[model samples]
Target: MPLHKIIHINETTTAYFWYITEDVTSLFRAVSLKDTSLFRLEGMKSEEHQRGFLAVRMLLQHLGYTDYDLSYDEAGKPHLSDGKHISISHSHEFSCICISNKLMGIDLEKLKEKTLKIAPRFMEVKHLENLTTSEQIEKATVIWGVKESIFKIKNEKGISFPEHIFEDEFDLKDGKCTAKLHFNNQIENFQIHFYNVEAYIFVCAFPNK
Candidate 1:
């Protein structure tokens, strides 16, 4: 059975929600799974990952993209066979893909309480000080999303949060924020866009020039 529920966020972005109603085996088959052993995930993690990939593949097919092939560069960032810019993200419940004629990145994270605990590791002193209210936790999560998006756009791993980037303190009244990139004085000026998706937040960045 095809994925009946489709939510089109925009012309360039689409999201699909899977309820996990089907068995794991069926889900894999729907995704045209072959040699599942390559993923090396087991149990619940395996199921979740497969489902996410299936949704992504279906979305790509819907977009008229055939001959879908993915390869990773030396930095481990996924590349496409057709040379199109693509970004893939998956949270606990949904998988998201952002494709555009220009370079882009997409991310979806489940809103959770643990964000507070991990805030320090990802946020800088200025970012924390900018919160200055009971809504610090929510603010931190948005910043984290910005960092994650930038990380994906750069396609480089091992990027330190807070120390490597910064986001302006802004109200959520507009449901979005602009962030600045600080990468060792080499690439110090760039902006990112942030938006909220229900309980989750999403950030996307591109070259400011």
Candidate 2:
């Protein structure tokens, strides 16, 4: 699939997803990559990762941009040339980018048992109580996505998932939630929206205003 889906998060933000079914050669030929990108792609160790990298560029081209329009800062956060905020993530076969006029973060994660098994390390395991096995996996994945999305937004050094980020209690039926980031002796709130995309969970977070 090309652009698999577009979620209009709000008037100012949109998320684009690309389903990666193309081989590395085909994807490489489709998009024009700047020299730096080409070098980075050549250095990748696996074809799966290479395809994901190229799929991100494909999404950019679909949006009337190119690799030249994308750059990253010292903190490894992506920036758009036209001054919009952009966040990118890829897992397994899906590549996605979220663009917003305001600062925000997006994360895509393939649901797996490992995330649920290690949930204790990053979140309050009490929140996972009383759910069926499947529901526990789904909810745990969403909470993990919430934390990852928020981390991408802050991108500050010394932030630990378990120590600084907390997802408020939320039900899977709600499709949204809130989180708190405790760092530097200050508390910051965030609004989160999440969805089930194929076998993956897509999460977006914005700093609470």
Clashes of each: 0, 0
Candidate 1 per-residue C-alpha lDDT over 44-111 given as tens digits, one digit per residue, 9 for 90 to 100: 46677766666666555656663236556777666667777777777766666666556666667776
Q: Name the lDDT value of residue 206 in candidate 2.
A: 97
lDDT of 2 at 171: 98
Q: Pick the candidate with the highest lDDT.
A: 2
lDDT of 2 by residue, 155-175 (tens): 999999999999999999998
Q: What is the lDDT of residue 62 in candidate 1?
A: 58
lDDT (CA) for every model shown? 0.62, 0.94
Best by TM-score: 2
* C-alpha RMSD between model 2 and the true structure: 0.8
Q: What are the runs in model 2 whose C-alpha is more than 4 Å off?
A: none
- lDDT of prediction 2: 0.94
